[model samples]
Target: MILVIDALNKHRFGGILDEMYKLRARVFRDRMGWDVMVRNGREIDLFDQLDPAYIVALDGSYNVVGCNRMLQTTGPHMLSDVFQDILCGEPPLRSATVWENTRFCIDSERLKRPGADRTVSYAACELMAGIAEYAFNSGISDVISVVDPAMDRILKRCDNAPYGYIGKTVQMGKTKALAALSDITEERIARIRAFAGITGEIFLEDDVVADALAESTPVTMPVALRDYCDAQIAGACTDSEREAALALQRELAGMYRSQPSCDA
Candidate 1:
């Protein structure tokens, strides 16, 4: 399943985000030898502070398997700040409808299998589907991705090829990289789905996410019931009375659990 994380709700998905950062550190900094920041096993940069949205793919255990980052082109982005040379003297494209995508990676150690075809990995296709669905839903018309030539070829092989590109491929560290633009539309998403043989929805619903998070944390008692329980405990005059109050509290807790969640 895929989970979309932005600045506003990142706090709600702390564990998943941590896993994503670690995966990025492994893929970009250690394996690819990119000169990106990696502190305490996490690859976080200044753009992360800019409230960029992330599309993350998770396995059955909720471990992050694949991920990608997106930022508004009108604001601080890679093409404008870090990869100005890629533009070859032209001013960086800035628009509300176009977004910059970068930091795309997958957890090869955890998700990859020996002798498995890398060209058609489930995690990779899920990440691509998440990006396309998110962009189409958010009124984004296009995405400009900074990717290496290998990734560029992968995109084409998956039928998600870029419609246009900016500047020639330039050597960045040990690998050659370039910028490619892809349109965000239902047709594009459908094409990816067909290629990946995915028939069902790849994105999890909000209520499903809430259930998963609730299962991980301790259940919180309702404020009024908690206050009543406290009052009962404080005002108890005998051991038997206190026991009765405690039993009532347990009953109330059961009732609360029986009630449907508001998020549901």
Candidate 2:
């Protein structure tokens, strides 16, 4: 349901990511009218180039249904660089243990479809739970996001309410925006799980999922091997070196192509 993508393995899931970006364009630009940048049908900005970790949601058919972006507070981020007004009079938060979570959105159309694997409410809760679990496991002490009052209430209702707030709420676009502070704790995660009736793991390891998919889909390779081969090809300084690197890539491509389909 949830796939955590960082700078490393993102290349392996390019199609899914395109859907996520398009979803962002719809939510932030068309729906919320936040004046976000949408280019070539994908919403992207400077923050995206900073290599922030992205948490993405997928449905039964592997459609990108939800997503969230996380960035270390010690570096450039939305609240610190773009939406600093949310800080009110105080300085922006900067810490190795605190991460700024932004671009939190879900695909309204897809999640509401009939016979979908997850409803919108459950997907949202799962995403929240995934974030909480990821943060707790990563040694992050806190996560912050600039959200409005309605979102605040939703968080509270979902049992993942922010323990504290920073700065004051002010009108940003259609609603008031404020800095929301949430502590990474087991209790919060438990409450979210209880509310959504979600048990077991919320996050799927990217590598493991890729490996499984590779087994089922011929011509698809695991991300690690693909990345290593790509690096070798890019770093080749001579014709022989280039052919050597290309040999492994060609052999694997043929091997994968020869595999019988699961239905077979």
Candidate 3:
């Protein structure tokens, strides 16, 4: 399944975000030999602080298997900020409707079986579908992604090849990288779905998503109190104890509901 997490709701997806970063470190820094930053086992950069949206792919166990980062082209992005050489003298493209995609990687070691080819996995197609669906629904018309030739070939094999190129390929460290633009439309999404044999929505259920957010979020004071209440409720053996725990939970819920809204 796919989960879309943006800046406003990122606090809910902390665990998934950590897994994605560690996966990026494994794929780009360790496997691909990219000169990206890997601090304390996480491959993060300045762009992460810009509050970009992330489309993350999860397996049956809800573990993060793949992810891609999306940033508005009008803001700080890879193509304009770090990959200027890929443009080959051409001006970097920027627009409100166009978004930049970068740091696309999959957890190959965990997701790929012993004899499986990582490029042709279902996780790749699912991640692409998630990106297309999320962007199309969000009023984004185009996405320019910084990718290597291997990714370019994988996209073509999956029948989701880029419609146009931004510039010539340039050598970055040990890999040849270039920019490719893809249209975000229902037709494009449909084509990917057809290839991937996905019939219904690939997103997780609303309740499951909420639970993931609530469980993964960093523990604050309120959260710590809630955890204690939950533990009390779970350990209650006598009927009276259970009733008291339930009443405490209800009181905490009421208190939470009565708090002033931050957005207000």
TM values, all candidates: 0.78, 0.80, 0.78
What's the lDDT for residue 44 in model 1?
78
For residues 53-123, write the lDDT of model 2, one tens digit per residue: 88888776567889999999998888878777777767888999999988899887887878888889999
- Off by more than 4 A, model 1: 113-120, 213-264
**Cα lDDT over the full model 1:** 0.80
The lowest-lDDT stretch of 10 consecutive residues in candidate 1 is: 230-239
Over all chains combined, what TM-score does candidate 2 have?
A: 0.80
Ranking of all predicted structures according to TM-score, beginning with the best and ending with the worst: 2, 3, 1
TM for candidate 3 is 0.78
What overall lDDT, based on C-alpha atoms, would model 2 receive against the true structure? 0.79
Model 3 regions lying over 4 Å from their true place = 113-120, 205-207, 212-264
- Please give the lDDT score at residue 179 for candidate 1: 97
Number of clashes found in candidate 3: 0
lDDT top scorer: 3
Q: Pick out the ten consecutive residues of candidate 2 with the lowest summed lDDT.
A: 230-239
Query: What do the candidate models score in CA lDDT, each in turn?
Result: 0.80, 0.79, 0.80
